[model samples]
Target chain A: MDCVLGIDGGGTKTVCIVMNAEKEILGRGETGASNYQSIGINAAFKSIELAIENAVIEALKTIKSLEVQVICLGLAGVNRPRDIEVIKKIVNDLQKSHRLPIMWELEQIIQPDNKSNNIIICHDALIALVGGICRDVGIVVAAGTGAIAYGRNHQGISKRVGGWGYILGDEGSAYQIAIAGMKAAIQAYDGRGELTSLVDVFTNHLQLETIEDLIEFVYRRGMGVKDIAAFATLVDSAAVDGDGVANEIIDDALGELVKATFTVIDAIFCPHIPNPSPQTIRNDDFEIVTTGSVWKGKSNIRERFIKVINQKYPYIKVILPRFEPAYGAGLLALKQYLQKSDSKAAH
Target chain B: MDCVLGIDGGGTKTVCIVMNAEKEILGRGETGASNYQSIGINAAFKSIELAIENAVIEALKTIKSLEVQVICLGLAGVNRPRDIEVIKKIVNDLQKSHRLPIMWELEQIIQPDNKSNNIIICHDALIALVGGICRDVGIVVAAGTGAIAYGRNHQGISKRVGGWGYILGDEGSAYQIAIAGMKAAIQAYDGRGELTSLVDVFTNHLQLETIEDLIEFVYRRGMGVKDIAAFATLVDSAAVDGDGVANEIIDDALGELVKATFTVIDAIFCPHIPNPSPQTIRNDDFEIVTTGSVWKGKSNIRERFIKVINQKYPYIKVILPRFEPAYGAGLLALKQYLQKSDSKAAH
Candidate 1:
């Protein structure tokens, strides 16, 4: 049996999986952020190496004489063309040290390609979308550090919207919502704006006396968007307590999310999402997939997102991805290895 | 000669003047905040009495006034009708104590009042505007603890904008701009947003290691807006030295100031600047009066304000009010006294 490795690198941690040609899970390992820009190339290389080595060693312990063939990775910060080369070099260097028949490849697996090519270099969001829909036609919104909405149709055409970073866009992303909440809380504390418990909660969370104290934790100290996003929970609590300001902020965030989803939906319908059936959407058949930490964590935001969509497009069915993005990557790697072996034999 | 009195009550300190009916300065005295809400009514009364007594004694020591015929007071926190009654009673009691023919009257003067009637209770901003223009027709913006703008035309009509206290409005006010700078500095420090040296300067000012330390001084400790506003100077210094984020904040604040002034400008031109003459604008026809500690303080904000205004309303001249709002209160008191005397004679 051939050992295949799949990796999912995130902002804080990386998850790795090792399996064989029989599709039996062998081993799993976890490491820290392997994103080049965040941990630096040196640290990223070390982390990725450690993660793969641990997973491979564990798999070998269980399945002796396993021949490794394919190594697939879906990294957090490797979205650009330049990142591909860097990742390739890292993998090649690791291969030199280990001396195994490991082929480095990106996990760009789109569900549409599942019918033929099977595997490709893609984002975890795409994986999550595929896991949710298990089909080619759908949309996925990944809300985490920042928010992005991506959509595809039966024809395999994909489009994106509202993925702007925290500074510009990101609309309904956790970070965006947290920033808004922080702004509101500060205004309330200073008597410059409306009042809310959000300030109290935020200040207490930061262990300060005033909402102004959070300015350090939020702006000066360089808190993560995820950390800021954590404040959304406080906002939700306040909204439940009947804080008009907090409620307004949540509503505003929901509005932004709806707008983002609508953008993808419009793309799926018009220039982006093609209409397979001219007669009816029921016959047209489409699905909306959700991805990232935001969807998996809080129910309030998730419910709000659904409520917004239901109010707008009641016909659309929203689906939660069945598997983690890393699993999607693993499936892609397995299929790819199988295709290669079959083609080689045919030739 | 009949002694006339002028009183200027403020958030921090109070000033009182005993002058002759001829409008000649006699003697002055100083005390503390006369706001009953901030300082209890008892303390306010004691401060007012002590201040007046000192001024009267000083005046008598020199001129030995035949009698204090009329006394005028421009007090702070006397905006409410009930507050006016409380102040009136205080003065009436003081007048009785003297056992002299002193006609006592109360004037509600805070700031941001247009030229209309005497003894108009206004925000301190209006007083500062009068400090600059000393005219009946002009506009004034106070940019100290909080920013507020007030303007009046020849017909006694006044307009105010961006005076929504320290939170919602007060756009380019010192406190607002200072908070902006502080937030930028903190954002840079945290890694959540752009980086700037504002954190360094702020920490240095507060004698702290990180921006987090300063947060308590501003929020938990309940520091005055002036203390927070003081940091704006540091932002300016940093910006001058080429801090990108600091520069961006300064520019953004300047933009807000421009928007605020335009509100006043728009109000002025609402009726077309009342072009009675065929000529464009007469030098004496229109003027902008500025007051308040923020505007008078030596900051780059003033120059930017002038630059922005000139860019839009070039033909209009900006001037300083000849009398402080407290002095205006004095004038108002004198006017009322004369009207009473005239009515008595007619009767």
Candidate 2:
């Protein structure tokens, strides 16, 4: 029985899954953060190996001879050429030792940029698509510690709507929400803005007496990005209470997210390619697949994203993915393997 | 012979001058910071006494038995009514010992608010006028750690134009300038803003590769406000070399000062305060007395303030203050005594 291994590595944790030839997830495991640049290469690679081992061990309990397989990993920091080469060598050595015909697929391989690894022009959003709705066409508005929106058309055309980092962009992202919350706190402290209990909560969290002191800490001190991101929950709580500043910040973020979604749709579904021009293919409408931590449950963000998207493109349908991103990677690998076999048969 | 004592007590040092009723400065002495809030009551009083003793000794050498009568002091941090009352008693006791009347003027009394201490009432700017032209109805733009512009019209009806403090106001203030400079350095480090040599100067001064560490020191470690204020000189030097960020901040401050001057003139001069306004009573075209360390020289700020004022109100003349703010305190106190005596004579 043919099998494929897929791994999704993130900043905080890594998720690995073993799958059969039919794209059925047989086993899974999780490990620590794999951001090599941040946490060092040795630690990151070791964690990846451990997660794969655990997943393989788990799969062995259900299926016999699980060692025979193809491996694929959707890693967070495999964008650079050096990182890709290092990960490739490690995966090749592991496959050789296991005595399996395993193929390592860097996330960038599917991402269009790596011409050598371009088996399919796919993205994390595409994996998100598989996770959100288990469908080809849908939209996934992901809002966790950060925020980004991804959508895939029925034609298997995937597009990234948002997900700009903490600073310049990332509308409706957790980081943006936290920044908004902090700004509100500052305004209230300075009397230039309204007062809120959110400020108190934030101050308490930071162990500061005044909002001014908190600002000084955040601005001057090199506070962690994640720590800053975590403040979004405080903002969300404050917004629920009727703090105008908190509400305004959330609303602003929502507006930006809506704008970002529309921008993505325009880029993919609009008549123009680069921009409005004479030679362009304008489609009537397209479905969008949505998935992620933010859209998983009952949050204001989910409803807002839906409402905003519907307001602009009422005809468009946003579907939720059925599987996780790791499983999606395995499925893509299976599809690629099948397509390659079929092409060989045709020859 | 009637004599007057003028004292300018600051944070670092105190200056005292003994003058005859004829407006002749007979003797001057310097001591420590007599701002009671900065130095304890005992130290502040002792400094004041020492300053006075030294000045008196000098005066005695020239004019023996110079019956020193009235004493006026311009003090820092003597703002509270209770504090003023306490300080008033202390000064009165000192005066009584010398058989003289004591007058106290708290600089903060002229401030608009706690945050707006840099902004002074029109009357307070008169001190800059006193030091500059030794006359009423002149303008004084003082820029030291902060910036304030004060001017008055004849008829003893003085008006203050600018002096808003370091944060919200205080255009052309050293603290503001320095902060602007520091921000530029930070932006350069972060790569979000334009590159400037201020980064090197600031980093070298603080002995750090980046401001990240220093920022924590300033905010988290409770660095001194004066030290923060010192960054302005660094900003000035950088801006002089055409550092984009520094230049922008400096230029912005200069613009603000110019606008503040116009605001004072508009409200205190022609339109609002009746046809024959304070400026008209001053007998000349509106005279703006520039005072303070920032406005003392032919710096860009001085030229800018004058240029902006002249561009709008062609008839308005710019005047530099002859004396410091402490001297203005003496001017106010002496004026009060002169008024009382004149009233007595009239009766």
Candidate 3:
């Protein structure tokens, strides 16, 4: 029986899954962060390797003769071409260093001898796109700690919008929303902006009495992006409780996200010329899959997002992911393996 | 002759001026940054002391026995009670360490020779207010690297709006405007925002082809608040060339500033309760003095700000500073010295 490996590496943690050719999940594993930018490349490599090993170990318990076929890694901080090359090299070196019993099995089942070729690497967002819609030709709006909109057409042509990070961009991100909420609270404290429940929420949440205490929290304590982003939940709760300022912040965030989604959708589907890519899929309908903490649960943001998109662009459909990013990566890897096998049979 | 000293200490440099009781400028001196938060307390003390010595040397060249009567320092980064105490101690320590021939003359001339009591400390904005209008009351709209509106009413009741710094607030500051322009340029580059000439302007200004190069400039080069604030000029130039996005950014900034100014004006002058302070100087008319680099020279931002304020708040008159912050500090010092002398004479 042939099994495939999928790994999703993010800034905070790494998750790995092992599955059969039929896409049945055999085993899963998780480890610390593998984002090379946050934790150095060596650390990222170690975390990814540990996650894969643990997943393989768990999968081997189920089947006696498990042949590993392909491996796909969907990782964060893989923006530039150099990042891809560096990560690919890390994986290649890991494969050479460790001759796992599963590697020997993989070597026997896969032909063309280059085991490294069996490994596929892509951005975490790409895998999320594939995982969300279970296809490559759609848009994925990922709004976690940060936010970005990415889309691809049938011809393999892709475009991205609004992933410039917290300082420069990330308009619809949790960080941005949380920052807006905090700013509103401070403004209210100073009597410069509208009064809101966020003042009490933030003061209590941060374990302080006054809204001005945030100044010390941010400046003196040196609160970082993730720490600040955590405040988005408080803002959401405040909005749910009918805080006008909180609602405005949510609406503003939704507006930015919708604007970004529109930009991506227009670029991919409604090009000035026919289709930009040669092998472009000429379909009028497209899915916009959203997968992030922000999209989870019953929130007005999600409802508003869907309503706005439906009203503005009727041809597009919004959805939650069919599977997680790791599963999507596994599907892509299986697809690649199948394509290679079919080409060999044709020859 | 008794000479009053006024010093303006900023993040970039320090300026000192010696003036007589009649407000005639005797001498001036300039030195490096004295903002304690940025350059440390010791360095701040050194810079301030050096500036005063230089000014005194210049003044002594004209007249002998130039006795120092009072000194006022308008400085940046001196927020909170602890900050005030720390800066006050720095000034007190400097006085103890240095005993110039000028100090001996001052000691001989002034009664009840407690020289430390002669020193007055205030935030840079306060000095700008006093300097702009040459009075203790009214409002000052300062839009330099950061932006803030501060007002003191006839009741001696004061209120402030904005100046929360780059991260939490500073809505209408040069830093904020520059950042908006940069974000717009990047968004335009990513096809996520409207096309603007800012893309080309930023490319040429930063000497890079793509907006992505800014990531390196900001993150790698460690561009700071003031560095980013400098880009406001580029944004202004782009706006002058009729970039719609740039114009919108400028207009948005002006709106925030005007809103903040209104908040300050309303809080100080339109109080429901009776005036709290004993030395209330009730008046119907008040001046709104504007200062800082953003207000200098020809810019639509200044014009729009003034026009909006005039239209909205007819009671508040907007005008440029009658004197620089240092000279304003001098005026304040002279006023305080005279008041103390009059009280003593009455006793």
Per-model CA lDDT versus the true structure? 0.64, 0.62, 0.80
For residues B239-280, could you state the per-residue lDDT of candidate 1 as single tens digits? 778888877777776676666666665565445664323234
* C-alpha lDDT of residue A81 in model 3: 71
The candidate with the higher lDDT, 2 or 3, is: 3
Better of 1 and 2 by DockQ: 2
| lDDT of candidate 1 over A1-30, digit per residue (tens) | 566677777778877777677656687778
Reproduced native contacts, each prediction? 0.00, 0.00, 0.72
Give Cα distance to truth, residue A10, candidate 2, Å: 0.2
Candidate whose DockQ is highest: 3
Best by lDDT: 3
Tens digits of per-residue lDDT for model 2 on B6-65? 777777888887776567777778998876665678888888888888877787777756
Q: Please identify model 1 stretches exceeding 4 Å from their true place.
A: A21-24, A99-120, A131-137, A190-192, A269-280, A284-286, A296-299, A311-315, B1-347
Q: What order do you get sorting by DockQ, best first?
A: 3, 2, 1
lDDT of 3 at A239: 85
Model 3, residue A75: distance off in Å is 3.4
- Report the CAPRI category for model 2: incorrect
How well is each residue in A38-147 modelled by candidate 3, as lDDT tens digits? 67889988888888778777888877766667888898757667788888787766666563446533344444564456778887888899888988889999988899
